[model samples]
Target chain A: MFRLLIEKELREIIGSTKFAVSFGVCSILILLAFYLGAANYLASVAQYNAARAENLRQLEGLTDWLAVRDYRIFLPPRPLTTLVSGIANDVGRTIEINGRGDLVAHDSRYGDEPIYAIFRFLDLDFVFQIVLSLFAIVFAYDSINGEKERGTLRLTFANAVPKAHYILAKLIGSYAALAVPLLIPLALGSLLLVVMGIPLSSNEWMRLGVIIATGIAYVGVFLTLSILLSSLTQRSSTSFLMLLVIWVMSVIIVPRGAVLLAGRAVSVPTIEENNAKKGKLNAQLWREDREAMTKFQPSSSSDPQRMASEFQKLMQEMADKRDARMKQLSDRLNEERTNAQQVQRGLAFGIARVSPAATFALATTALAGTSLDLEYLFRDAALAYQQAYAGFMFKKTGVNLSRGMIIMRTESGDPEKPKSINANELPVFTYSERGVSEVMQAVLPDIGLLLLYNVLFFAGAFVAFLRYDLR
Target chain B: MESGQPVFEAIGLTKKYEDETLALDHVSFSVRAGEIFAMLGGNGAGKTTTINLFLNFIEPTEGEARINGIASHKDPLTAKRNVAFVSENVMLYPNFTALQNLDYFSRLGGKTQYSKENYHAVLRRVGLQEEAHTKRLRGFSKGMRQKCGIAIAILKDAPAILLDEPTSGLDPQAGFEFIELLRSLRDDGKSILMSTHDIFRAKEVADVVGIMNRGKLIMQKHAAELAGHDLEELYMKYIAGHIRDAA
Candidate 1:
C-alpha cells in the first residue's frame, strides 16, 4: 500500500510541467556554477603566479640583503574557495613582511576588483542556498492542500489508506523525485572539476562530498517545511503565500538580521580607534629615543669605520627598544578587540542558526576553509613567516632589516663590483589550510542543526497531516 | 453475508462544528446489501455530513458510523477497507490518464490483482471511450471525470459504496447513464448510499429513499411504499418543517 502511494505521487509530480521547468532551471544553474567556479579558480592561479614572479623579478640585482624592500607574501587561493567563497575574497591576501613591525595583510581581491564584489561570484554555495531551496519550496508548498482543493484527498482517504502511510509516502516520494534528478548535475559538475584540472586532494574531495550532502539536507528542510505549511492551511493559495513569506525570512532576512541585532548588543572598538591608541604610544617613545640619539658622543681618537660601527649598534638598540614598546601596546589592544568580536560572533551565529539555510552556509564554508576564520588564519601564518625572514636577515646583514636602517656605500675611486644577493634564498611563505579533521569538527554542529531542522519539520508535517480535515 | 444484512450503519451519528453549527444531529440510518438508499436534501441539510462520518473523514460529535459492522471512528482503516467513495466533483489526478488513475486507485483500495485489461474493461463499463482511457484527465469534462470516478469505485469491488451528491452536475443524458450504472451496481449486490437533491431521479432508481432537513432525518420509506405518493411534495413538506414523522 505504501509503495503504491509513493509510485502515484512520483508519477503525479514527474508528469507535471511544473516539475519539468524547475528541474531544467536547477540543472542549468548548478552546471553554470561549476563551470564558473573552475574558470574563476584558473584565473586566480594565473594572477597569483604572475604576481609572485614579479615580486622575485624586482628582488634581482640587489647587492645586499638589507636593501631588500617591498618583499610581499601572498595568500594562495584554494580550489574550494572558488565554490564556497565565504569571506575569502573580502579578506586581504597580500602581506608585506618588513620583519619588524606588525604584519598587516593588504590587497584583498574585492578591494582590488570592486566590480566582482558588486555581484558576488555564482558559486556552489549560492546555488544551493538561494536556488535549490526555492525549488524545494516550489515542489512541495502545495503537496497536501492542493489535493484537498482538487477533491482528491477525500477520494483517497475514502479507502483503507492510513494517514501515516500517506504522509510518509508523500515526503519520501517528493524528496526522491526532486533530489535524485539533482545528482545528475552534481555528478557532471564534479566531472567538470576533473576535466578542468582543478587538483583537489582526497581530503578536499571528502569535504566537497559532505558539502553536497549538506546541500541536499538543506533542500529537505524547505521541502518538509512546505509540506507542513500545506497541511496546516485550508487552501493551496494561502499555503503558498505563507510559504513564500517563510522562505524570505529564513533565506534572506534571519541570518543578516541576527548579525545586525548582535552588533547593537555588543560594543567593540573600531580599527581606527585602536590604531590611534597605538600611534600615541609610538609618538611618545620616538621622542624619548630621539633625545637619547642626540646625547650620543663619539669615542676619542676613533677610527672612521669603528666610529660608524659604534653608531650603528647604538641606533639598532634604540630601534629595538621602541619596537618592543609598540609591540606591547599593539598586542593588548588587538586582544581586547578580538575578545569582543568573538563574543559578538558567537551570539550572532547562535541566533542565525535558527534558519537551516544559515546553518548550511556555515557548514559548507567551514568545509571549504573559506570561513570568516580565514582572515585570522592568513594573518597568523604571515606573522609566523615574518619571524623566519627576520632571523635570516639578521644572520646575513648583522642587523634587523625592518629596523629603518640606512645603508651607506662610500666607495673609493677604484672599488670592485659587489656580488648580487640571491633572491632565491628568501624564506618562502606557505599558507596552511585547516586539516580535514579540524574542519569536520567545526562543521559538525551546523550539520547537526540542519538535520534537526529536517526531522522537526517532517514531524510537524506528519502531525499536521494526521489531524488534517480531508473534507 | 446475507442478502439483507446491513453493509453501512449509522446509529445516532451526530456532528457539530466548532462554530456551534449543528451539521448532523442524532441521525440514524442503514444501507443493506443489494440496497440503493438515496438521501435527498437541500444545502446544509446534513446529507453530506453523514457520508463524511461513514468515510471517517471527520470524527462524529456523538455516536458511531459503522461500515460492515466496524465503527468508522474507532477503527477507520478497517472500516474504510470495506467501503468506496465518490465525491461530488469526482476530481481524480488531472495529470494522469484514466487508465493510470484507475490502476492507482485500485491498488490503494487493496485490489492490486487487477490487470490493465481489467482497468480498460471497467472504464468501458462506466461508458468512458477507449480513446479517452489513455488521455490525461486534465482536459476531461465533468461527465468524463464522473465516469472515471465510478470506474474506480467499481474496480475497488467493495461491498459498500458512498456517493455524495454524485449526480448534482451531470446533464440529462449523463445523469440517466449514471442512474443506469448505479442500478447495475445494485444488481451486483453492492450496497450504495448516495446523497442528492434530485427527487425524480431518486424516485426512479432508489430502492429506499431518505429525506433530511437541518441535521434531522425527517422522512424515510421504501420505494414500494412511496409508489403512489408524491416524493417532491413530501420532500418539500419535510424540508419546510411541516411533517416530522412521515417514515
Candidate 2:
C-alpha cells in the first residue's frame, strides 16, 4: 500500500513539466560550477609555480643565504576549496617567511580579482543553499494544499489509507524525485574534475562525498519545511508566500544579521590600533639600541678576526633583545585580540546555526577545509615551515637568522663569476589537511542539527496533515 | 451478517461548523444491501456533509456514520476499506492516466490483485472508451472523468459506495448512463448513498429518496410509495419552507 502511494507520488512529480525545467537548470548550473572550479584551480597552480620560479630567479647570483630577502611562500590551492570556496577567496594567499619580525599574509584572490567576489563562486554550497532550496520549495510548497485546491485531498482520504503512511509517502517520494536526480549533475561535475585532470586524493573523494550528502540533507530541510507549511495553510498561494518569507529569513537574513549583531555586541581591537602601538614600541626600542651601538668598541681590535667576531656578537645580542621585546608585546596584543574575536565568532556562528542553510554552509566549508579557519590554518602551516627554514639558514651561515641580523660580507670577486645560492636547499612548506575523522567530528553537530530539523519538520507535517481539513 | 442488515447508516449524526452553523442536525438514514439511497436537497442542505461524515473526511459533532456495521470515526481505515467514495468533482491526480488512477484508487481501497486487464475491463464497464483508458486524465472531459470515478468504485467492489454529487456536472445523456450504471451496481448487492439536487433523477433511480432541509431530513419515501408522484414539485415545496405549514 505504501509502495503504491509512493509510486503515485513519483508519477505525479516526474510527469510534471516543473520537474523537467528545474532539473535542467540545476544540471547546467552544477556542471558550470565544476568546470569553473577546475579552471580556477589550474590558474592558481600556474600562478603558484610562476611565483616560486620568480623568487628563485631573483636569487640567481646571491651567494650569501642571508642576502636573500622577501622569499615568499604561497598558499597552495586545494581542489575542494574551489567547490565550497568559503573564505578561500576572501583570505590572503601569500605569506612572506622572514628571518625577522612578525609576519602578515597578503595578496587575496578577491583583492586581485574583484569581479568573482562580487557574484561569488557558483559553488556546490551556493547551489544547495539558494538554487536547490528554491526548487524544493517550488516542488513542495503546495504538496498537500495543492491536493486540497484540486479537490484530490478529499478523494484520497476517502480510501483506507492512514494519514501517516500517506504523508510519509509524500515526503519520501518527493525527496527521491527531487534529490536523486540532483546526484546526476553532482556525479557529472565530479567526472568533469577528473576529465580536466585535477587529481583528487582518496581523502578528497571522501570529503566530496560528504559534501554531496550534506547538500542532499540541506535540500531535505526545505522539502519537509514546505510540506509542513503546506499542511498548515488552506491555500497553496498562502503556503508559498509563507514559505518564501521563511526561505528569505533562513537563507539570507538570519546568518548575516547574526554576524552584524555579533560584531556590534562583541568588542575586538582593530588591526590599526595594534599596528600603531607596535610601531611606537619599535621606535622606542630602536632609539635605545642605536644609543647603545654608538658606544660599541671592539675590545680586541688588535686581532682582526677577534674584532669581527666581537662586533657580530654584540650586534646579535642587541637584535635578540629587540626581537624578544617585540615578541612579548605582539604576543600580548594578538592573544587579546584572538580571545575577543573568538567570542565574537562563536556568538555569530551559534546564532547563524539557527538556520539550516547556515549550518550547511558552515559544515561543508569546514569539511572542505576552507572556512574562516582557512586563514589561521595557512598561517599556522607557514609558521611551522619557518622553524625548519630558520634551522636551514643557521646551518648555511653559522648564524641564526631569527636574530634578525643584517650580515654584510664584502667579497672582492668578479660579479659575473659569483656563485649562485641553491634555491632547492630552502625548506619546502607542505600543508597538512585536517583528517577526515577530525572534520567529521567537528561538523557532527551541524549534521545532527540538520537531521533534527528533518525529523521535527517531518513530524510537524505529519501532525498537521492528520488534522488537515481535506475539503 | 444478516441479509436484512443495513450496509450503511447514520445514527443521530450531527455536525456544527466552527462558525456555529449546524451542517447536519441529527440526520439519520440507512441503506441496506442492494439499496439505492438518493439524498436530494438544495445547496448547503447537509447532503454532502452526510457523505463526508461517512467517509470520515470530517468528524461528526454527534453520533455515528457507520459502514458495514463499523463506525467510520471509531476506526476509519478499517471502515473505509468496506466502502468506496467518488467526490463531486471526480478529481484524481491530473498527471495519472485514467487506468493509472483506477489502479491507484483500487489499490488504496485494498484491492491489490486487480490487473491491467481488470482495470481496462472496469473502465470499459463504466463506458469509458478503450482509447481513453491509457491517456492522462489532465485533458479528460467532465463526463470522461466521472466515468473514471465510477470505474474506480466498480474496481473496489466494496459493499457500499458514497458519491457526493457524482453527476453534478455530467450532461443529460451522461447522467442517464450513470443512472443505469448505478442501477446495475445496486443489482450486484452494493449499497449506494448518493447526494444530489436532481429530484427527477432521484425519483427515477433511487429505491429510497430522502429530502433534506437545512440540516434535517424532512421527508423520505420508498420508490414504491413515491411512484406516480411529482418529485420536483415536492422538492421545491420542501425547499421553500412550506412543508412545516402543510404539516
Candidate 3:
C-alpha cells in the first residue's frame, strides 16, 4: 500500500510541468553561480599577483643587491587559494618590511587602495546561504496543500496508511529530490578544484564534509517549515506566497536590518579616530625622546669627531625608542578597534538570529575560515610577522635605517637574508587548523536553532494533519 | 441477498446544521434483504441527508444508521465495504480515461487484477460502447458518463448498492435503459436502495416505494399492494396533504 502511494505521488509530481520547470531553473542558477564564482576568484588572483610583482620590483630598486637583507617581500596568493579562497586575499599585504620596530605597518602602498577590499571574491559561504534555502522553500511549499487543491488528499487518506507516515514520505522524497541536484553540482565543483591542482588534505575533506552536512541540515529545517505552513493553509497559492515572503525576509531583509541596528546600537568608531590617537602618541614620544637625546649630547668639543659620532649613535637609539613607543600606541589602537568591532558584530549576530539565513551564513563562513573573524586572526598574524621581521633586521644590522638607509654592508652573501638576522631563526606564519570540537562549539547554537525549527514545524504539522478531514 | 435480515436500518436519524435548520428530523426507515426500495421525495425533502447518514459523510445529530447489521458511525469502513454508492453525477478523475478510472476505484476498494477483458465485459453489461473506453472524460456526455458510472458499480460487486437519483439527467431512452439494468441486477439477487423523484419509473421498477416530506417518512407501500392506484396520483396526494397540514 505504501509502495503504491509512493508511486502515485511520484507519478503526479512528474506529470506536472511545474516540477520540471522549477528543477531546471534551480540547476541553471546553480551552474551560473559556479561559473561566476570561479571567474571572480581567477580575476582577483591575477590582479593580486600582478600588484605584488610590481611591489617587489619597487622594493628591489630601494635596496641594493647585497643589502636586500633590509627587506622581505610577501608575494601574492598561492594556487590553493582558489579552492577555499579563505581570508588570504582580504588581509594580505604585497609589501613586506624588515626594519627596527615592535610593530610594523601593513602593506603601506596597498592600504591606500580601498577599492580592492570591496571587490574581493565572496566565498562558498555566500552560495549556500542564498541559493540553497530558496530552493528548499520552493520544493516544500506545495507538498501538502497542492494535493488538497487537486482533491487527491481524500483518495490518498482513504487508504489505511496513517497521515504521519504520509507526511514523512513526502518530506523524505522532496528532500532527496532537492539535495540530489545540489550534491551533484557541488561534487563536480570540488572535482574541478582538484583537477585545477588546488590542494586539499584529509583534514580539509573532513571540514568540507561537515560544512556540507550543516548546509543540508539548514535546508531541511526550512523545508520542514514550508511543509508545515502548507499543511496549515487551505490554498496552495496562499501557502506558496507566504513561503516566498518568509524567504525574502530571512535571506534579504533581516540580515541587513540587523547590521544596521547593530551599527546604531554601539556606534562603531571611525578609522580616523583610531589613527588620530596613534598620531598623537607618536608625536609626544618623538618630542620626549629628542629632548632626552639633546641632554645626553656631550658639552665638550675637544674630541669633536667622537662627539659627533656618539651624538649620531645617541640619536639612532632615541629614534628606535620613538619607533617602539609609536608601535605600542598603534597596537593599543588596533586592540580597541578589534574590541569595538567584536561588540558590534556580536550585536549584529544576535539581531540576525531572527533570520535563519543569517545563522546559516555565519556557520558556513566560520567553517570555511572565510569569516570576518578569520580576517581578524589573519590580520593579527600579519602584524606579528611584520614586527618579528623588523626586530630581526634591527638587532642584526649595525646601521639604524630609521632615518632611511645609508648603504650598510656593501658586499654580502644571500642579499635577501633579513638584515642583522639569522635566516632560520624567525617563526613562520603557521596558522593552526581549527579543531572539529571548536568548530562544533562555534556552530552548536545555530545547529540547535535549526533543529528547534525542524521540531517545531513537524510538531505543528503533525497536530494540524491529525485533525484534517480527508473528505 | 441474505435471508431473514435487514441490510439497512435508520433509527430516528437526525441532523441539524450550524444554522439550526433541521436537515433530517426523526427520520427512520429499514430495508430487508432482496428488496428493491425506492425513496420518492420532492426537492429539499431530506433525501440526500438520509443517504449521507447511511454513507456517514457527516455525523448525525441524534440516533444512527446501520448497514449489513453494523453501525456505520462506529465502523465506517466496515459499513462502507458492504455497500457501493452511485450519486446523481459521480465525481471521478477527469484526467483519467474511463478504463483507468474503473481500475483506480477497483484498486481503492482493495481489489486488483481487473484486466482489460474484465472491464470491457462489465462495460458491455452496462451497454457502454467499447470505443468509448480509452477516451478522456473531458468531452463525455452525461448519459455516457452515467453508463461509465454504472459500469463501475457493476465492477465493484458490493452486496448493497445505494444510488441517488440515478435517472435525474438522463433522456427518456437512457432512463428506460437504466431501469432495465437495475431490473437485471435485482434478478441477480442484489439489494438496491435508490432515491428518486420519478413516480412513473418507481411504479414501473420498484418493489417498494417510500415517500418522504419535511424530513418525515410520510408513506411506504409495496408496489404490488398499490397495483390499482396511479403512483403519480398517490405521490401528489401524499405531498399535497403533508404540505397543507404543515401550513
Best by TM-score: 1
Judged by lDDT relative to the true structure, which candidate is superior, 1 or 2? 1
Question: Over the true interface residues, superposed, what is the Cα RMSD of model 1?
Answer: 0.7
The TM-scores, one per candidate, come to 0.95, 0.93, 0.74
* Stretches of model 1 off by over 4 angstroms after superposition: A291-317, A402-414, B242-247
For model 1 chain A, where is the 10-residue window of minimal lDDT?
A400-409
RMSD of 3: 6.2
lDDT digits (tens) for residues B117-174 of candidate 1 = 9999999999998999999999999999999999999998999999988898899999
Query: Which model scores highest in DockQ?
Result: 1
lDDT of 2 by residue, B1-247 (tens): 5887999999999999899999999988899999999999888889988988998888999999999999999999889888988888887888889988888888888788988999988888889988999999999999999999889888889999988898888899999999999999999999999998888788889999999978899888999998878989878877676456636
Number of clashes found in candidate 2: 0
For each candidate, the alpha-carbon lDDT, in order, equals 0.91, 0.90, 0.70
Chain A only: give the TM-score of model 3.
Answer: 0.78
Cα-based RMSD of the predictions, in order?
A: 2.4, 3.1, 6.2
Interface RMSD values, listed in order for every candidate: 0.7, 1.1, 3.9
Candidate 2: residue B166 lDDT (0-100): 83
Residue-pair clashes per candidate, as listed? 0, 0, 2
B-chain TM-score of model 3: 0.95
DockQ of model 3, rounded to 2 decimals: 0.20
Residues A1-471, candidate 2: write the lDDT tens digits. 899888888889988989999999999999998999999899989998898899889888888787888888889999999988999999888888875556788899999999988899888888899999999999999999999988788878888888889999999999999988999999999999999999899999999999999889999999999999999999999999999999999999999999999999999999899999999999999999889888889887789999878877887888789889898999999999999999999999999999999999999999999988888888888888788888888998876777766756676766675477888888888888789999999999999899899999999999999898887
